[model samples]
Each structure stands twice: as structure tokens, then as C-alpha cells.
Target: MATNQNFIGGFQVNRHLLIAGAALTGAGALIGLTGTVIVGAALASAGRGWVRQLDTPPSELATRKLHQARAASLAGLEAWRTGTDGSPN
Candidate 1:
């Protein structure tokens, strides 16, 4: 009977497989870290832009958005009062 030196009991341990697994694990970790960094940078940039917007008074566009939102809410209330929400007559 012939037995490999890397065999323990009845199981054989392959060095190449272990090395490949370790390399893949390292690559996955690096990729995850890079993605996290990119997302964090994008969030930071967006936050800064939001802060810059807040430093200025509301623009005409902002006022128009607010008015539009109020108008939509009023329209919704009117619809509710009129029972136009798809109810069986």
C-alpha cells in the first residue's frame, strides 16, 4: 500500500487548494472594502452638497415644489371627500 506524506488518517490535504482558497478569500475581502469606500465617498459628497444647499435661502424651484406638494395634498383631500377612491357605489 502507498500513502502520501500529506495524508492524515484516511483524508488527504492538498496544499494547492488551501492556497487558492486563501487567495480567493483575500480578494473578496479587498473587493468588499473597495465597495464600502466608494459608497462612503459618494454619501459624503452628497451630504456636502446638501449642506451647501441649506446655506442658501429657498430658491424659486424649492418654493414651487412646496406649492406643488401643498396643492397635491389639497387635491387628495378633495378626492377623499368626493369618495373618488374606487369604492363600489
Candidate 2:
């Protein structure tokens, strides 16, 4: 008589399937861990940059420039709405 069976530690199981499942599980875990590390590093770097920006005070010239730019944009919008900018309707 001939038989085909696999026994491991007194347990009859398919060894090939078990090994393949383990390899797949490990690969998934590795990819998940790598993604987590990359995201964590990116967040950490951004936090550092944010902290640095918070520690610095805005320059007077830069603030003035921002205000001027905002005023100019608002004026342009107003002129366009009233058709005072002289562009063809």
C-alpha cells in the first residue's frame, strides 16, 4: 500500500500552504511597518519646521508687503465689480 501525507510534530498539516501563508503575512507586516515609519518621519520633520516658524517673529517689511498685496487685490476686485477698470464688457 502507498500513502501520501505530511506530519509535523505529530500533527497532519499541509506544510507548503503553511509556509506560503507565513511568507505572505510577513511581507504584509513589513510593508505596513515601512509605511508607518515613513509617515512618522515626515510628520516629525513638519513639526520641527512648524516649531521653528512659531519661534520666529514676522518681519515688519514682510508684514507691510503682505498688507499691501491684500489691499491691491481687494482694490482690483472692487474696480472689476464696478466696471471701473475700463475692460470691455
TM-score for every candidate vs. truth? 0.51, 0.50
Supply the TM-score for candidate 1. 0.51
- The local distance difference test score of model 2 is 0.81
- Which candidate number maximizes lDDT? 1
Give lDDT tens digits, candidate 2, residues 8-70. 665565667778899999999999999999999999999878766774545665798899999
The list of candidate 2 runs beyond 4 A from truth reads: 1-11, 56-89
Per-residue lDDT value at 86 in model 1 = 60
**lDDT of the candidates, in the order given:** 0.83, 0.81
- Superposed on all Cα atoms, model 2 deviates from the true structure by an RMSD in Å of 8.2
Clashes of each: 0, 0
Question: Tens-digit lDDT track for model 1 on 1-89?
Answer: 23333455767656677778999999999999999999999999998888777855467668989999999999999999988996777
